[model samples]
Target: MTLSAPPVPDNDLMRYLRERGSTRNFKTDPIPDAWLEALLAAGQRAPTSSNMQVYSIVVVKDAQTKQKLAEFAGNQKHIIDSPVFLALCADLNGPALACEMHGTSFHGQTFEKGLVAAIDASLVGMTISLAAGTMGLSTVMIGAMRNKPLEVAELLGLPPRVFVVFGLCVGWPKTSPIPKPRLPMPAVVHQERYDASRLPELVEQYNRELAQYYRDQNRETPDDAWTQVISDKYSKPARQHLRQHLNTLGFGLE
Candidate 1:
């Protein structure tokens, strides 16, 4: 039997999803407390692995703290300029506490547990971003939060087994940025099986598209913009000390 494709709904949510872009230039307008609470509530509604909810979100509004975080994140001024900075953290501390309450020693130092917590934090962070967008707020995910994980933990007063996986800068947009182009769908989405025969072609196509996008925005970029950027980023050993740092943060990753 041939199954028909489901009808696509053209709605506000769909428009929001399509139009959402990283907001680096933000207005200094404060996010209302009610909206902040709502955003947190939205994050809590995200699905968790085994309902463990092994994640925490540290909200930073203080200018001084945001400045420090900005420095830690390679001096990204958005963290300081945005009204709110959120450190989305992977937290094994709560699970450990639960084990202690049962008079059992926690043996979740394995790589799988570490992965679970990271995934939990990532899911919640994305949810919060989406929710914020719906409320006329824009956000940018700061992966550089991992650049100084130990420092971030100390600054946030995170207990052992807790580390910032990433951060989010949220506020009103000073100006909307053009949504960056993405790789062709087939390049990423595999059908019934994993196919990579078209990867090189797809990458070249994406490179041209991204280069044109940059040109449209009057931004200087290499001809093979996406490919060149990726090459430069990964050519060197990036985040070589992350494993050791995570270990120090109590994620054994064994």
Candidate 2:
């Protein structure tokens, strides 16, 4: 049976969240400039560290540019199909400049500063996804933009102290996929003090749940255990060169 899309909630944020899923298939329909601007405004409202919004959003609408971006992101068709693609960047130039103007020491090149900026940028991207969903739009986040960070920076004409964190595709969805099941609350959430005794059991139960979820969708289930899936993915050091890339962008990972 084809998994049906969850029903839209009646003014319920939680329900909407429960129904939310990453949309890979996007229609070619154009999003109105007003709607796009509104969505961006909503993303801008996300909380920032120390009120220092250390993030930049590069909105891409040009077809050839989108195609090149798609190629850079492992040839994801969604990047090209979506009417809009927003490249979210962890930026330190603004902070550095601000500090310079105030005759203070700039710390934007530090590893810790880069981490914080990345967090801020990720938060804004998530906010944009949620905002777009609420407005009957669909979105998919692409972290593969980091596959060639330097090339991406060059394509976007980013100066030193700025790095692309991720890309977000936005537009009307061609089809709605069911939300993938997440680990049970007990497995992820903890009471005041951390508890780990039941972790093994909890993980096993969720593994079964996810396996059944995949079976229900008639998708080929390769790995049944969630732990196994994660282990296999992280077994090798992926993106190990990112440290050097960040260094080249003026971030001191020291």
Candidate 3:
């Protein structure tokens, strides 16, 4: 992959969207402390559910720790090579303890509540990615943290009622990866009636477009484009059912 300067930001946010790509290669240059701080600050500035902010970010920087995380992520080298790795967690311990200290009872820690926390953490994580991109940094989201939820929780020293939601890699880009193809706008957006009438037609057009995109990039052609990919995904062996796992981790999915 060859590197290239970012496209200048034009009127319609084209440059911002075009230049952003998941970067895997990173130079050995040490990331500046202020830039790291700025990234975290941008994450903190993102919206939270009811301002509870029941989430946390664990910075993984030590070589050994990064290796451990990388191993957990199926030995994805980028996890270890990136200057920083963040384990975004959904946390209930903070609010629970805060309530305990104040002699106040908090009963909103339901499965839905946990969902909100996870969403908040994810939103913050993506904000960091955007902020990093704006500053010429690169990033990749790691959903593989859920591969071994229990192990990740132990590695991060997460307390009861706190669990790893996802991971992220952040660093300067080494090369410019081409932007992946996306479905057309109309395929996603809907008006008041929630019109899904155009789905079949839209899917067909998108499949053709995506196949062309793949061919242009010299990538292998997908069998049936988006729909087939999604069908195959669900057809695969099931992943860990989080309900029971959450029981051990202190999330009452009831």
Kindly list the per-residue Cα lDDT of model 3 for residues 1-254, writing each as its tens digit.
99898986584335767756788887656679899999999999999988989889998888888898889878999988898998998888778888899999976458798788889889999888888888888899998888778888898898888878889999877887678777777778887668888888888888888888778978787846777887888988754566677668887768
In model 3, what is the error at residue 195, expressed in angstroms?
0.9
Candidate 1: where is the Cα deviation over 4 Å? 1-6
Per-candidate TM equals 0.96, 0.92, 0.89
Candidate 1 local lDDT, 166-234, one digit each (tens): 999999998876789899999999999999999999999999999999999999999999999999888
Tell me the alpha-carbon RMSD of every candidate. 1.6, 6.1, 6.4
Which candidate leads in lDDT?
Answer: 1
Worst 10 residues of 1 by lDDT: 11-20
Task: Report the C-alpha lDDT of model 2 over 48-100, residue by residue, as the tens digit.
Answer: 99988999999999999899999999999999999999999999888898999
lDDT of 1: 0.94
Residue 68 of model 2, lDDT score: 93
Query: TM-score of the candidate numbered 1?
Result: 0.96
Give stretches of model 3 more than 4 Å off: 1-14
TM-score of 2: 0.92
Backbone clash numbers for all candidates listed: 0, 0, 0
Q: Which ten residues in a row have the lowest lDDT in candidate 3?
A: 11-20
Pairs of residues clashing in candidate 3: none
